[model samples]
Target: MVSLVASSFMQVACAADSEGTSPNNQDKPASSWDDISDKLKVATTKGLSKLSWGLEWLGYKSGFGEQCTFVEHPSLAVRKHLQANLKAQDRAVDVLVASIEAWERTHAKDHAPLVLALTGPTGTGKTESSNLLAEALFKWTKRLDHSDKDSPSGLLVFRGEDFSDNYTNPVSQYQEQIKSRLAEHLFRCSGKALVVFDEVQKVIPHTLDVLTSAMSSNAHLTYHRGGVERRIDTADVVFLLISDIGVAKMEQLLIQYDDRRHVPATQLENDVKRALDAQWTRLQFGKMVRQVVPFLPFEPQHIVLVIQAKLDQLSEYYQGVYWKSLAFDPALAPHLSTLESMLYIERRAVVRGVDVRKVFAKYGARNVETGPLQQLKSKLMRYARPWNPEAQFTVRLMPDERTIEIVACVEARANDQDKANEDGGGGAIDTLSCVSRWQGEFT
Candidate 1:
């Protein structure tokens, strides 16, 4: 009797276990995020997952075959914000990206309701981050692998040029375009978009006024064509407006004087308020800040970080074998060094381009044939190794003459091939000879 009862208990236990393990169990799969705000909070508080980015980049290149450039620092920050929609465990936020995340966390909703107004100096990556976020949004929806070479079909990028043609009739022209784009944006992916407006200050007031109403009132813009007018809703949109308006004011103060010197917070607030009330006359910002969103001005460190980050990104992009064959030419090494230095100086120059070569020529770069430059190029090319067609490389430089100023005469190239010196061996020739090939993209 006892053995029979124990056998029956085992069978009941097995039945219970089977029921729990069944596919129709009570717990559903963890996928769709009922509240995207929570996911954003995780992103803002914990920064982005680098592993995810690596995977995405791999997929983008290998799966999609589309060309994508990654910018570090601000670019990384932008990438995080763009991909913030994805949720996972073990998220970690970096100190460098705290402000942006904090701002996002402070304002979250079912849709991307935050309209981040990032204001900073020229190199601060405000524009970069905004662009990345928009791009990521497009990529996310297309579900195309990063490694796939095929380009996504639905991409609507709005640049200042798009609105430039209608500058004279600002409101009317802009209204038409804005309405159309908005319609398209909603028709396909209603609440799942990343819209960015760079240099918001450049936007005309009347046009800005429309954007302001659309954002604040969450109203759809209406347009009339052939005596027909239509209105749409815009409650689930993520709008990003970037500007350099406060940059000049911020940089001059920060660089000239360590921002340790503080104006009373109240005083700054009052000044901002005064500026806000005077918006109608100023007409530059269209009362956007005073009316629409917060204006966050980046500090000096932010500028330095952005510039350094851009350089690092460029270096990484150029590190591969793209230019291996050219870089390895025994005859081209010295020219590459000169080119690199020239680019650095050119960046510092007031005006850039071929004039940079003239500067080098004026410095008595010799330009005589078979001169020190030839030797240097040969030696460097040898060091670079043989040309590898499969190698990827990047070249970018500014045409600045000063690049050659510090070089010893032994390294200078000649101005002419056959021409000799005025006094024979003194080595005189054309001032502009031994031209080096230019490589890399110039901004």
Candidate 2:
């Protein structure tokens, strides 16, 4: 293992040196031996850190000692991400920050894990918020680190439907399985795991009792099987429970306030907790939850921003793939307005003399990506060609509102223009022609 780590360190050092100096700088003076040695030392340190992390993950001790710890304070990163990407979720973001800060302060003491319940309507950023938290906590790279069936990347997900009682299997069986799985994973992770339980309302009471017990324990999670007792420390673990339990009441509150910004966050959270408590009277885990965060519905303007952001991302991707400049027509605002109408539904409630109104997505942002944006990607792929890699291509919506046209701006050179004039044709300096047309329904 030492030799393998050393070899990796050397490779990383060489790669870093090569990437630092481009081909254009080849004629410059070579770096001194001292500089190269410093780079090697830096690469070796990084390599050892990664190696230590791997060893620790596999339940092995590393020679590096405490330097191998991977958990980080994610307050700043998470706050910035939520502020920039998530809209109309100030209360949720605040609760998450407070929970993390509190955990940081008391993690050394033996205590139960922090349990947060995220309750809201569908497509209200519940999943996105959890993913962000995971990324920040573990410093995870989406492309490099991923969760699979065989192994978890510090983030474990469990669906409520998977634990439901069936004819062949009973709820008690699922409870035991979950307990075992949690114990093993928590042990391997050294209690630094972020476990997400989605659709919590669908989870049977029997299974929920098991989960509640795990969170309500002190310092360690104990499991006994085959007359053998195993205890795993869980002081750093966090449980994120996602549900749509009080969506109706939340919408009603939004309506009462006339604006989501005016809704009292404390009142909203208390109301949701009461609703959850009423529904799950058997376990009553609602009262035990550390915090209850609410995700409000999205307005029309927020939906427009989301759609535009998706298009912007697609444009950046195609620019690299097609090696051409991709541009959107400025006249797309009308089309975006039409799309916003199709994406969300409006609800109204009358309280006193005020008419409360709220808007939310019919199908969440995930559907938007899989539905219209996916089709848009396919159309771009079918039409985009690298014939003139330096030319600019404009994407436009047709009058029918269902078709898209890719128009290429082809500039006529002086020689081409002269030839055209000699051949008895109009000599145009700049020519715009429709290269490809894609006709499809949105959604």
Candidate 3:
């Protein structure tokens, strides 16, 4: 910011002095007022832009990128986010932050991407925590769009299971495909890039073997095509590998130590690392990890917190962007119920792994793609089971299913006064009770 301010001032000063006549000159040419005026306009615009940016940096303005960075230590910000959004990973948070910081510093000179492996249980925030690191560096995490065939440059996402199924694709061909696809993105990006590999456990050893070459001293993958070596640069990149490889086992380990309360991070890290290492070894994926951040299973309470965070987020979003006249109950219709009951419902939903934001989107009350809530909405969608918006649904229970469907989407008839009157002023159910997590799978 200091350099930016100084640069702006210099440009202004240079522009002002470019056509000025000397005061002592005997004969002087007429100065073009238009040119001077244009310079002033440009200078003012640039100055104001810089000034606004400075204000944002100084906390006087709310700008997109400003609030996401580290004030001094990025780890502090990362910790703050995790402590607030996640639970029972205080030690993991420190290790993760320290790992990333250490890797970045060393990798700048080493000329290879720093690779991190995040292993954890299903609902734990391993991926979300990685994203916190992403936001710290890039001001915002650039999400890879699956819908678009053309991925946005610099950020590429690979899902492990996509290349799985040996019957469908031969291992040799799959390996080549993985290498070539990754190489394509790596070469296209200028300078450093961030590539995230999610569900790493599902990826076959042959496909992940591409990493051995990518993480080499030269930091480039070599592929022989037509008897010529073609190289793709990956030296100046960051690779985050997220997996549930030992997740179930890790969860079991943590549960064994649940009552200990003061279990050391080093011990937890070691145990989880062993579990993940066993998986990696069993899968025959050779060692390539510089750091391993093990995300433990969140206590059921933590899921409640994450769900509550989502609720608070929605409240803020609606406050900021709610259309004044558009009122027909919030996406959470039973908000009119007692606050205690409403909270109970929300918490129960969280325990059930029901993402309320997706529920909102399901009812058409929320347009998830067009607001600040998109990130939260996206995360919620991941846990959401598919539901048809147009089809009429029933509330009856099926004995064949293990998971209970809590279908509560009721369109308001307030807009249609006739229907409202017929139903005795909108017959909305307000009863909310907690249900235990289903022990088995349900469709």
Candidate 4:
């Protein structure tokens, strides 16, 4: 395990060093596709590392390759698409958009067209990848260190709001205007282009048909307006159709087919995942299967992974330093969990309007002095057991994970003993004392 971790660290270090190209320096054309692929692999690996870092912080090992995975397009397919659309007129604009420029140069222009779609459920990051690809192509080559899945980048996205025209009538009027405006923007930006249609299913069929020609035939979609017809050039654009309806439908089907009542954790996670997969199986859009990316719903485990990953990064950056001197304080664990639960669940049950202010101020320690940190301390105190009416339970962080486990058992027994002793006179043997007398018990 030590050797594996050491090797992983070394790879991360090496990737970081290579990522830092001087800002003034421009990316020179790579001699071969292999070189680009190798470089891209490093970037891809680094991107995954950040994702894993977030996962580990949530309290679990990264399952990126094992379960949480993204789809990848082959260099050959990408190159073929690029070469076919990249002509002399598009050379300047297309170069900036595509990373696999070398392979693209080899393929002939004006051949069979290429159209790629990125379809998935809501929040699975279909539109997000489009933005990331755009940013990687046009702005910085490296992915951002701190980026959310929903973070947008270089792609030009058109939402349903953009097509705010009468759907009852032919969409030619407003759809043409939208296409014309969008085409002008892409044409002006001399580089590779990406067009994302979020919730494409909501779009009118005629509008979708217009897009089909531009995507499949590599032919420009003409929009007639004001005595002239304008063409939206899509030869160099990667078209993406993102949707959630398919996944929603699949979820409904699963709810019916599988028993929804009293489902086990394993079954719940699997059913949700199966529902997402079914979405792809029932895909209806024309030739959408060729470009489909079935996004799975995030399971609790996934969120746990992200949190654990974040913790790992924090641990590394801090040189394994605990957040504070008391971060690991054993007293803090149970209290922390309790505090979190109190804050998260049944907010009304834990803290509310009047209780909120009282929580910030120590119950009896202070006479309502308003100090933020102290108040925070008071609120967290709610998690601790109220023993010895006058004594405040000292919240401590344990350095060892084992210490936490052992202390928890001790605390449980102590609470029971304290309750039992409460009936007895003030001077009495505590639970810890009784526990210490046990011959076989290990501390």
Candidate 2, residue 398: lDDT: 78
Residues 251-330, candidate 2: write the lDDT tens digits: 77777764677888788888888887886675356755888888777665655666677777666766644646778766
How far is 426's C-alpha from truth in model 1 (Å)?
56
Error of 1 at 258 (Å): 3.1
* All-Cα superposition RMSD per candidate: 18.2, 7.7, 14.5, 20.7
Instruction: Please list the residue runs of candidate 4 whose C-alpha ends up more than 4 Å from where it truly belongs after superposition.
Output: 1-114, 139-154, 164-170, 223-233, 248-289, 309-443
TM-score of each: 0.44, 0.72, 0.55, 0.39
Number of backbone-clashing residue pairs for each candidate, in the order shown: 38, 0, 0, 29
Top candidate by lDDT: 2
lDDT of the structure predicted as candidate 4: 0.40
Candidate 1 regions exceeding 4 Å error are 1-112, 135-156, 161-167, 222-231, 255-443
**Compared with the true structure, what per-residue lDDT tens digits does model 3 show for residues 377-405?**
44334432243232222222236432223
Give Cα-based local distance difference scores for all models: 0.41, 0.69, 0.54, 0.40
In model 1, what lDDT does residue 349 have?
Answer: 25
Please provide, for model 1 over 387-420, each residue's C-alpha lDDT reduced to its tens digit, 9 standing for 90 to 100.
Answer: 4333433222235522221111112345542444
> In lDDT terms, how accurate is model 3?
0.54
The numbered model that scores best in TM-score is: 2
